[model samples]
Target: MVNNILPFDDSDLTKMITRQINRSWNFSSKVEDKLSTELKDLIRQMLEPDANKRPTITKVLRHPWLRDTSGVTGISLTAKTSNVVGKKK
Candidate 1:
């Protein structure tokens, strides 16, 4: 969902698969319009070709981009739950 396009997206199935296996992922814009730097960094690390260099699952989950989500979650889930309950009653 980062750019509303899948990695190595193409009309030809074979070409798309080939690119996925052989090419590094990329974006069109000079700078991403919506993604944060932290997120971009995490994606880059995760995309590293060397498995030894990629972060562990725990590290990935603990990354600041995922751990600190206050910027993305404007309304707390608790508040949303309460609103839904009130409507039901």
Candidate 2:
């Protein structure tokens, strides 16, 4: 999404990949200035390099920034059920 606004230079791809490998990504200042705090927090949580520390899909659905408070739960039980069914051996 940030790429839509401030495009990344092809020359920066190597540096970006290196940073990702090192788990030291730096978001563009323009993104920080333009996006909301909640959105930024969510993005950060989603980008966590440690799989154990990263938010689960269900947890992400419950995030304040993404949750729908109008009597509608963001997570669907059917999706959960499907996942369980698919995992059955």
Candidate 3:
């Protein structure tokens, strides 16, 4: 998503697979300026080489980036059971 393309090319599938297995694959340098630091950090955490060191779903949800919902607006459906059931429409 960051690069708007796959990190590895289809023509080099074998080499790409080898790099993935070796945990040597990474986003291109070009993406550094294109993505935010927080986003890059989150991506790095998600792609941690060690599974045990990766952030849990809960942790990810609570990350500063996700927690800061300022400027974002959306409808709250918790109290709109009738609307969800098509009763209000």
Top lDDT hit: 1
RMSD of each: 8.1, 5.1, 7.2
What TM-score against the true fold does each predicted structure earn?
Answer: 0.57, 0.55, 0.59
What is the C-alpha lDDT profile of model 2 across 1-89, one tens digit per residue?
A: 85244223447898766665566755677566777677778877887767899998767767877653456667665566557555746
CA error at residue 37 for candidate 2, angstroms:
0.7
Cα displacement (angstroms), candidate 3, residue 89, comes to: 33
The true-versus-predicted C-alpha distance at residue 30 of model 3, in Å, is: 4.9
**What stretches of model 2 exceed 4 Å from their correct place?**
2-18, 68-89
> lDDT of each structure?
0.69, 0.66, 0.68
lDDT of 2: 0.66
Per-residue lDDT for 1-89 in model 1, tens only? 67556666678988776765565677546447577889888888776656888897657766788767575757554445556555743
Per-residue CA lDDT of model 3 for 1-89, tens digit only, reads: 87666755568888877765566766677777877678778877876757898897657765676656577678433334435454543
As a whole number from 0 to 100, the lDDT of residue 5 in candidate 1 is: 64
Rank the models by lDDT, top first: 1, 3, 2
Let me know the TM-score candidate 1 reaches against the reference structure.
Answer: 0.57
**What pairs collide in candidate 3?**
none
